[model samples]
Target chain A: MQSLIVDLGERSYPIYIGQNILCEALIKPFIKGNQVMVVTNDTIAPLYLDHLLAHLSGLSVDVTVLPDGESYKDLTHLNLIFDNLLKNKHNRTTTLIALGGGVVGDMTGFAAASYQRGVDFIQIPTTVLSQVDSSVGGKTGVNHPLGKNMIGAFYQPQLVVADISVFATLPDRELSAGIAEVIKYGLIYDYSFFCWLEENIERLVARDADILMQAIHRSCEIKAEVVAQDEKEAGIRAWLNLGHTFGHAIETHQGYGNWLHGEAVAAGTMMALSLSVQMGWISIEDMDRVRRLFEKANLPVTPPKNMSSNDFIDLMSVDKKVLNGQLRLVLLKTLGEAVVTADYSKEKLMDVLSA
Target chain B: MQSLIVDLGERSYPIYIGQNILCEALIKPFIKGNQVMVVTNDTIAPLYLDHLLAHLSGLSVDVTVLPDGESYKDLTHLNLIFDNLLKNKHNRTTTLIALGGGVVGDMTGFAAASYQRGVDFIQIPTTVLSQVDSSVGGKTGVNHPLGKNMIGAFYQPQLVVADISVFATLPDRELSAGIAEVIKYGLIYDYSFFCWLEENIERLVARDADILMQAIHRSCEIKAEVVAQDEKEAGIRAWLNLGHTFGHAIETHQGYGNWLHGEAVAAGTMMALSLSVQMGWISIEDMDRVRRLFEKANLPVTPPKNMSSNDFIDLMSVDKKVLNGQLRLVLLKTLGEAVVTADYSKEKLMDVLSA
Candidate 1:
C-alpha cells in the first residue's frame, strides 16, 4: 500500500491506495474508538460489507444499509443512518465507517459530523469516483431537493482506504465517471498528468491496476495539497470545483439520478473549457484535448439536449459559487492552470451555452 | 455594550451583551455578505422582526418565520430556511441572522452551517437562555423525535448581539428557564457565583437589567473559558453539560415543546445533585441549596412522574455523553466543582431516578 497524507493540521488524515488491502490490520490503526458502525448502500453492501466486517471482527460493529443512487441522498435517507446510530446507542466515541461509493461516503461522513454534534468517521471508498475524489476531502453532506449538496459540512474523516481491487466490480459507466474527475486534475493543474492520462486512457479502461493506482494517487496528491492550504474553500480550494458549477445545474435539471455526478461534471468540464476558449484564455487545441480525453473515457462531453441556455443560467445562478449575486466559476487560464473568477461577460457565456 | 470574546482562534467571535444594540451599525460589521436572511419564529417575529429590519435597511434582506416552539426544531423547519434561501437565490456568502430564542438560533445556525456547506451567521439572541448559553458556543442544530439535538453541527456565528432589552418582552416562564442555566454556571464551577445566586435569585427572577446583565456576563465568562479549551466537548467542555444528559431525557420523554430546555435542565440539575449526594460528594443540605435556587427562579425541580427508572436509563444510555456503551454523566464533586465520567454505580443512579 502507498500512503499520502492530507495535511490539515490537527484534522490531517492519511489516504491509503493499493490492491486487495481492505483488512482489519490496515483499518484498525485509524479507528479511535471501540464502537464501529459500517454504513453502506444496497448496491455495495453484498459485494464488500462482509469483507469489511471480517476486518472489524471482535469490535462493536453495526451496519446500516441504505438504498442505492444519488436520488436517495436527502435528509430522509440521512435519517436512516442517524436512526440506526441512535437506536443502537452509538455515542460520540463511536467511529462510523463509510464503506461504499460517494453517496454512502457523503451521507455517512455527514452522519458522523452531525451525530452528537460530530464523531469520528473512517472512509473506505469502494468506487473509482469516490476513492480518488469525494472520500479524500472533508466535504460531507446530503443534497436538498432545491439543490445538490445544498446541506453539508467540512467534517474530515479519520482515514481513507481506497482498495483498487474493488474497482473491478464497478460498472463501465461508473469507472468512466471516475475518469472524468481524473482528467479534471490534469486539465486544471498538471499538463504532464494530462499527457499521462492521454497515454494511459486505454490502460485505465482495461482496468490495469498499476495505471489506475497511479491516477488515483496523483489526483489525491493534488487534492490533498489544495485542501491543506485552503481546507474550507476560502481561496484556492475552490479551484478544485472547476466544472462543478455547470455540472450541478445539469444534475439538478436532469434530476440527480438520471445523470451521475461525474457524468455531469464531465460535461460541465467541457463547458468550462468552451468558456475558456471564448475568453481567449486557451487555444481551441487545448479545448479539443479536454474533449478528446472525456470522449476517450466514454464520458459525456455536453449537457442534456433538452436543457436550454436559460435553464443553465437559472440553475447556475443559485450555485454555491455565486458571490455578491455574480456567478463565480473556476475557468482554466491554460491546460495546467485554473482560477475562480466572474471576469467573463454574460453574452460570451451564453454563446458557449447556445453552441 | 459589554463585549466578551469566545477565544476559538480563527473561529473565535465576540459576544456583545447589553441593551438596545441591535442596529445596522452594530450588526453590519460582522456580516460577511450583503445578502441577509433573518430567521425567526412566529412568536419572536411579531416582537423584534421590525426592529431587526430597521437595522438591515438598504440590504437584500429576507425573513422566514417558523412556528414558535421546541417541537418545531426539526429538519422540516430547517428546510424552510433552506427553501427560502434557494428560492431567493441566497449564495454561500449570504449571512444568516438568527433573531429569536434558542430554538430559532439553533436551527438558523445549523442552516448557515449546512447551507452550501457553510455560511456566515450572526446571532441576535432575544432570549436570556440563548444570550447566556447557546449563543456563546458554536453548537448549532435541530432536534430529532428520538432525541434532542440528535442532528446538528458545531458551527459558530460571526458575532453574537445579546439584546437584554428583548428580555423585557419575554414571558415569565421563559425568563425562569434562562435562570436555570445561569444557576448552572454557579453550581458546576463557581462557589462564589453559587453564593451570589443564593443572594440574587429573587433579583434575577424579577428581571433587573443590571443584575441580569451581570448574571449573563458571568455565565458567558465561565462557558467561554470551558469552550475555548475544549470546543468539541472532548474534556472539560462536558462539564458545561452538567445536567444535559438527564435533561435531554426529560425533554425527549416529555416531548420537546412540553418541557422547555431550561425547565428540563432545571430538573436534571437537581437530579444530578441527588446523584452527587448519593455518591457522598455533597450533603443533603447542599442538594437542597441547589434545589432552592431552581425553586427561587420558578423552574421545575423534578422530571415527569410517568417516566420510570428504565425510561431514564434507556434514554440517557443513548446520550451524546455515552462512551464505549457506558453512560457517562457530568456530576458535581461539590457545589462548585463538576466532572464527567461513567465511573459510577447503576444502583445509585436508579435510586435517584426512582426517587
Candidate 2:
C-alpha cells in the first residue's frame, strides 16, 4: 500500500492506495465515534456496500443507499443522507463513511460537514475519477439546478481509502472518464509526469495493475501538493481547475449525467489547450500531443456538436471561477504549467467555441 | 455604538450594537466584493429593504425575500438563496447579507458558507432573537424534517450590525421571545447579569433602549467568550447549548413556527432547571426565580400540555448533543454555572419530564 498526506495542518489526513485493502483494521483508527453511517449509491451498494459493512463490524452501523449518477448530486439527494443520519439518531460524534464514486463522496462529505454542525467522515472512493480527484481534495458539495457544485463546503475527511481493486469492475467508459482527471494533474503541475503519461497511457487504458497504481499515486501526490499550498482554492489551487470551468459548462449545458464529469473535463481540457496554442503560449504540436493522449485514453476531445459559442459564453459566465464579471480559465503557459487567467482574447475564445 | 469582537484569530469579526447603524459605511468595509445579495424575509423586506438599499449605493445589489417564520427554515427555502445567487450571476467574491430574524440569518449564513464552497457574509440581524443569539454565533443551517437545525455549518459572518432601533417595530410577543436568550446568558454564566435582569426585566419588555442594549451586549459578550475558547463546540462551547437540546425537542414536537425558538428555549430552560433541581444541583428557589423571570417576560415556563415524557425522550434522543448513544444535557451545577453531561439518573430526568 502507498500512502500520501494532504497537509492541511490540523486538518491534514492520509490517503491510502492499494488493491483490496478495504478492511476493518485499515479503517478502524479513523472512526472517531462508535455510530457510523455508510452512505453509498444503489449501483455501488449492490457491489460493495456489504463488503464495506462487513469490515465495519462491532460498531453501530447504518447504510443509506442513494440512486447512482451525477444527476443525483443535488440538494434533494444530499438531504437523503441527512435524513438517514438523523433517522438513525447519528450525533455530532458519529462518523459518516462515503462508499461510492465522486457523487457519493461529495454528498456524504457535505452531509458530514453540516450534520450537527460537522462530524468526522471517511472517503472510500470506488471509481478512478473519485479516487484520483474528488476524494483527494477537501472540496465536497452538491450541485444546484443552475450550476454544478454551486452548493457545498470545503470540508476535509478524516481518512481516504482508495481500493484499486474496485476498478476491475468499472465500465470501460467510466475508466476512461477517471483518466481525464489523472491527465489533469500532469497538465497542470508536472511536466515529467505528463511525459510519463504519454508513454504509459496505453498500459493505463489496458488496466495494467502496476501502471494504474503509479498513475493514481502520482496524480494524488500532485493534488496533495496543490491543496496543501491552497486549501480553499484562494491562489495556486485554482490551477486544479485547468479544464473544470469549460467542463462545468459542458456538464450544465448537457444537463448533467448525460456526459460523465471526466468526459466533459477531457473535452474541456482540449479546448483550453487549443486556446493556449492560439494565445501563442504553447505550440500547436504541444496541444496535439495532449489531444492524442486524451484520444488514446478514449476520452472526448471537443464539446458536443449541439453546443455553440453562445452556450459556452452563457454558461461560463456563471461559473464559480468568474470574478467581478470576468471569466477565468486555466490555460497552459507550456505543456505542463498552467495559469488561471481572463487575459485571453475573446475573439479567439469565440473561435474555439464556434469550432 | 458599542462594539465587541468575537476573537477567532483570522476568522474573528466585530458585533456592532447600536441604534440605526445599518448604513453603507458600516457595511461597506466588511463586504469583500462589489456584488452583494441581501437575503431577508417578506416581513422584513417591506420594512427595511428599501431603507437598507438606499444606503447601499454604487455596489451591485440584489434581494431575495423568503416567507417569514421558522417553518420556512428548511433546505427548500434555503435553495431560493442559491437560486437567486446563480440567477443574478453572484460569484465567489460576492457577499451575502442576512437581513432578518434567526431563520433568515441561519439560512443566509449557511448559504454563504456553502455558496461556491464558501463566501463572505455580513449579519444584519433585525430581530432580538437573531441579534442576541443566532447572529452572534457562526452556527448557521436549515432544519431537516427529522430534526431542527440537524443540518448546517458553523460559518461566521464578516460583520454583524444589530440595529436596536428595529425593536421599535418588533411585536410584543417577539420582543419577549428575544429576551429569553438574553436571560439565558444570566442563568448559565453571569449571576450578576441574572440579578440585573431581575431588576430590569420589565423595562426590557417595554423596549427600553438602554436596558435592552445592556442585555444584548452582555449576552453577546458571554457568547463571544465561550465561542472564542471553543469555536467548534468541542468543549466549553457546548455550555452555550444549555437549554437547546430540550428546546429543540419542544420546537420539533410542536412543529417549527408554532412556538418561537426563544419561547421554546424559555420553557426548555425551566425544564432543565427542574432537572437540575431534581439532580440536587440547584435549589427549588433557584428554579422558581427563573420561572418568575420568564413569567414577567411573558415567555412560557413549561412545555405544551399535550407533550408527555415519552415525547421529550423520543425527540431529545435525536438532538446533536447526544454522544455515543448517551444523551448529554447541559445542566446547571449551580445558579450561575452550567455543565454538559449524561451523568444524571434517567429516572430523575423522567421525573422532571413527567412533571
**lDDT per model vs. reference:** 0.90, 0.92
Candidate 2 at B220: error in angstroms? 0.8
Please give, for residues A203-259, the per-residue lDDT of candidate 2 as tens digits.
999999889889999999999999999899988999999888889999999988999
Q: Tell me the tens digit of each residue's lDDT in model 1 across A47-81.
A: 99888898987789999999999999999999999
Docking class of 1: high
Clashing pairs in 2: none
Model 1: per-residue Cα lDDT at residue A123: 95
Error of 1 at B87 (Å): 0.9
Displacement of residue A262 (Cα, Å) in model 1 is 1.8
Pairs that collide, model 1: none
- Residue-level lDDT of model 1, residues B226-319, one tens digit each, is 8999998879989989888889999898888888999999999989888988999999999988888888899889899999988998788878
Docking quality of model 2: it rates as: high
Lowest-lDDT window of 10 residues in candidate 1 chain A? A24-33
Which of the numbered candidates is closest to the native, going by highest TM-score?
2
- Clashes (backbone N, CA, C under 3 Å), per candidate, total 0, 0
